[model samples]
Target: MTGNLHAGALLLAAAPIGRPEDASPRLREALSAAPVVAAEDTRRLRRLAGDLGVAVTGRIVSYYDQNEASRATELLAELLAGRDVLVITDAGMPGVSDPGYRLVREAVAHDVRVTVLPGPSAVTTALVVSGLPTDRFCFEGFPPRKAGERSRRFAALADEPRTMVFFEAPHRLAATLEALAEAFGADRPAAVCRELTKTYEEIRRAPLGALAEWAADGVRGEITLVVGGAPEPAGLSDPADLAAAVADRVAAGTPRKEAITAVAKENGVPKRVVYDAVVAAK
Candidate 1:
């Protein structure tokens, strides 16, 4: 907001998600420059500072979800006191799945100027490497952990045309994949991105079913999943049940290119025939 900016500056810095070496030079400079540092995990922050060989002269304070509300007023007070304050989360950008959202919102409401230190983010990184359509996309964040809620959640996004991205825990990855397969259909194209920029980083592109089966053995580390979207609706020339199968895949998460390929391959028909039918249907 204008209050802080007019008075001084409040910086929102992005912390490394996994690899500490990803720390930007500006971030390191900001760490030492800012007088007060509000960190999600002070211990980790201290360790990062040590690794970077930067001595922080700032007064470190904890600002996590549990204490953010009460701490916000104090942090804002620091800004109002004409002290430059820097906020950092444990990983990635703050507010995506981290702290600092409330403080930022309050700062804006109170006319305190807010600035962000742009850096690595799992959401965008996963999307670009996902190999799905990237022209248009939406980050769904993390899906519900429970089976019932998770199933219902995936059911809602069954027809999302843009590439969809989600964060999943390693232990829950298998169940999540299975649920996606059932909700979006087993054959829908998808990719699982794990350990983003870290050394063991891996991106597996395959149908949802194949990933689900692989996850049965259990996958670990930070997981980002990108699922293909609903396919264009078309008709079949099976003379028996072309429209039904096409509609099923379309409702699931099969795009035109994939749907045409899968339907023609399954029904013993020409790909052009299915493509024309879909175009006419639309």
Candidate 2:
């Protein structure tokens, strides 16, 4: 019976990341035009429609990450019946670090045509407003909340040449900037964009060290940090100097694991060899 149904179509609609007034006319029309609206949070979706003065004509259903797996088949069923299934996340584009990835994957598997409605994006908004170099950049999504894991992740990004953008909670902004300073260097240029595109929007551009100090006082609203990457180091290709760095950190009370990470990052060498050498010495 499912095989006999017409091909399904999935609509990925971008939601306002911060403000309701940013809703595009097309988004409002889609809200009223879709036969079914799959929302990350149906109540919030309804509220948004109310604020936009557009009544949703379709049935509203929850389709977030937790339920996406079990609900995909059902939503696909509705779509296959020639219903326009509009997928809206709580904010921003549906699949960008949001709940729509799984459903989109399922839709593709079912031979359903999928397209997006471009609208307000926190990533791009924060990047341009940040006053940092944006000629080459990459969206890092969000960093790990746990400090240890977050440190490790930042360490891995030490060699990234282009500018980087990341989403962070306001509460964690200080610690994240501190880690960026340690991994990238205190003198590296950076920008902290808070409450972007909202009435309280703020952008602070400074060295990572200074920004970390400023964020220590506490900031609110959604936060995005654009950080400069590790600069090309001088004499990084010297093996003996790299080995000496490993030895010095170990002498300074850094653990073998931590020391290896620090030295490999400083020398632009892979950590495996340094780790193997430390293990051999032990």
| lDDT top scorer | 1
Candidate 1: residue pairs that collide: 1-111, 1-112, 1-113, 2-111, 3-111, 4-112, 231-254
Which 10 consecutive positions of candidate 1 have the poorest summed lDDT? 1-10
The runs of at least 3 residues in candidate 1 whose Cα sits more than 4 Å from the true structure, single-residue gaps closed, are: 1-6, 235-282
Return the TM-score for each candidate structure: 0.80, 0.81
**lDDT (CA) per prediction:** 0.85, 0.85
TM-score for candidate 1, please give it: 0.80
Please, what's the RMSD in Å of model 2? 5.0
- Against the correct fold, how does model 2 do in TM-score? 0.81
Off by over 4 Å in 2: 1-5, 236-282
Put down candidate 2 lDDT per residue, 1-282, tens digits, no spaces: 243248657899999987899999999999999989999999999999999999999899998878988888898888778887999988889888777888778777777788899998888887888777788899898899999999999989978988899999889999999998988789989988887777988888999999999999998888888887666756445555556677888799988678888887666667886666556555
Q: In model 2, where is the ten-residue run with the lowest total lDDT?
A: 1-10
Could you give candidate 1's per-residue lDDT for residues 108-179 as a string of tens digits? 777777888999888888889888889889989889988899999999988788899898899999999999
